[model samples]
Target: MNGRFDLNSLPMCGAKTRHGIPCKRKGNKKNGRCKLHGGHATGAKTELGQLASRANAQKDFPDWFFGKPVKTEYVIRALSSYEKLVELMLADEIDWDTVFDVVEQDQIPLEMLKYYIMFNVTPEALIIIQSALDTYYQETHAPHLAFHVYAPMIVFHKFFRQLSAPDREYLANWFKKYSSRHPGYNW
Candidate 1:
């Protein structure tokens, strides 16, 4: 006999059923199982089986499967609402005083407030908000609140490019004064 085993020379799986009938099909070269009983055998092909397959796939990625809102999704929704407010303000539907009132009341969240000041406020609107912040700071004697209000200027400094020269100078002077008052403050 030749030393090499050819495909034809490979043995059948010869696996028996409960009734003891031979499998009769050709076996795999590796595992020696018939194609029907091989590990590569396909799952069920029925509609119900397909649905179960899809469900199993979804189970592997439950977040996408359940359509849950992620952290960025909530931020996007908040920015959308903020954009709507800015639109109304620009259209003269809502006045600066109302926006200032919202900030004074602490109705706006700190994160959204930072975005609002950086992206949406005009020089004129900024003056009003700054004045309100000054008043709040004086009344409460809370330098931290002032820091919180201006922290966005440092964080979103790129937005400073949109400011007029006078506005930029004013903000620089403000920061200088704030720093002098709170020498230990890093911001």
Candidate 2:
């Protein structure tokens, strides 16, 4: 078997085209016809089939963070830094240049936070989310607890405090497990 992967190498459908050309579509072993022709399955077309197809397509998506979609890992880590930077900025200890750099770097989170207020996400929720995310981030170097999970969390935050006790306990466990992963939150 040559390493080439051209149509000539595979078994072709025995059917003929309107122009009398041999069917170039791959044939199924049972009936020698591709799905387009007369293969056993014709693909998902019904409502249930379509829903199943969509669910299969979505199988790779990560689970929601507190019922909110999370930003990518890099954005999350930077946002953790952004949270810390903001505190240092408020203290007026960090230079403006450094503070601006971090803020500019975390554009995704900042923008989401900026406009989310218009949609009714109170600054109070923002405080809780940031603290949680930053804590998770520092603890594991894998901060996913918060930051710009964007619309999902923004929408979910309204119900943040009312989450099931088990979910809250899970988060509490994460904090306990890695409480001092980072050096004392300094600098």
Q: How do the residues 86-154 of candidate 1 rate in per-residue lDDT, one tens digit apiece?
A: 554566455656555544444223233444454565435444444545554565575434232211222
* Model 1, position 21: C-alpha lDDT score: 90
lDDT of 2 at 179: 56
lDDT by residue (1-187, candidate 2, tens digit) is 6776665545778677788877778876667686667645667864334535654675434333335444565446545755555565557364655544554455345444432432454455455435433544464475343333323334444544555677667666655555556546532
Q: Quote the lDDT for 131 in model 1.
A: 50
lDDT (Cα) of model 2: 0.52
Question: Which residue pairs collide, candidate 2?
Answer: 137-143
Q: Ten-residue segment with the worst summed lDDT in candidate 2?
A: 143-152
Q: Which candidate achieves the best TM-score against the true structure?
A: 2
In order, candidate lDDTs are: 0.51, 0.52
Each candidate structure's TM-score, on Cα atoms with residue i matched to residue i, is 0.25, 0.26
